[model samples]
Target: MLKVYGRANSINVRKVLWMLDETGQSYSREDWGRGYRATGEPDFIKLSTFGVVPVIEDNGFVLRESHAIVRYLANKYGRTDLYPADLKARAVVESWMDWAQTDLYAAARPVFHAMIVNAADPATAVAPTDGVKSWAAQMLRLEQYLTGHGPFLAGDQFTVADIPAGLVVNRWFTLRFDKPSLPAITAYYDRLSERPAFRTHGRNGTP
Candidate 1:
């Protein structure tokens, strides 16, 4: 069985869980990070030196980093449709995955950290406002991408690319920031919200 170590509410962990659910793979989840940091304990640290929440123990392979874990799963367990077998199609999805980590996280982290962890009102946080503005602007880029395709980031077919973006959408909505008109992103979220995996992950608010 695959063992996942992370708190339920974590966006990173949520992405991994969502992907697993999408793949219809069963795994064990452990409470860790934020409310619990088992990753910091000597035993867990021996496995994941970074002490991150989303550590995956599959068979004997121990891996950390949420995005990497999901990508690994997509390649290993995902139907070729999700990860895709064609090089160009796979590249398209993988590009979004990398963009989510590099660009989306850069924009969303400050807003999420201030609003959720610092317990500061988003309206009052200068960094969060700036961060949200950046995030919303970045979302416009995604909106443009999605505008050409319905219901999915990569295209007509849903893929692993949607997983992290879905988690980011939850954070964006929760922050209560004034988002620029993004019909495509909104529609995408609406679709994702209907998924059982997203609903299951939504049960607990971020810690």
Candidate 2:
């Protein structure tokens, strides 16, 4: 059986867990890092030099990094769908996955810190107003991407692109941050939220 080590509430961890659910692949999970408090263990450090959550051991082939995990699973389990055999389609989907980590993280970080780490009491938090403003703008761009394709970020098929971005989208909707007009993003979020796997692992928006 595949095994995953990470805290359930972690955004990165949620990316892996939600992808597994979407792929319908069963795996065992252990709590690790940050809120779960197992990040510094020598064993975990051995597996991941950075000691991050979302380390997976699949038949002894260890893989770290949240995006890699989702992509690995998508390739193994969802070959023609989540991964896409067509080169162009695969490139399109992977671009969003990369964007989620690179571009999206800048917008997502402060908002998540303000809402989850400091607790949603804005007065006590670092005041992520600017962060949320930036996030909302990026989300508007994302909404345009989703709406342009109608339902999915790429097209009719739900793919690995949705896994990481879905995790971010859940936080964007749940955290009480001031957001710009986003009816399209709201509709897109509503569709993703309706998925059972999304609610089970990613929707709580705190980790």
The numbered model that scores best in lDDT is 2
- Model 2, backbone clash pairs (residues 3+ apart or across chains), number: 0
Please, what are the lDDT tens digits per residue for candidate 1 over residues 17-47? 9888888989999898876766678987888
**Candidate 2 lDDT tens digits, 94-203:** 89888987878778888787766766664455546788778777787887776667687877877888887878887777666456777777787778778888888877
Q: List the residue pairs that clash in candidate 1.
A: 33-36
Stretches of candidate 1 above 4 Å error? Answer: 120-127, 202-207
Report the error of model 1 at residue 44, Å.
1.6
Q: C-alpha displacement of 73 in model 1, angstroms?
A: 1.6
Candidate 1 local Cα displacement, residue 206, angstroms: 4.9
What's model 2's lDDT at 167? 80
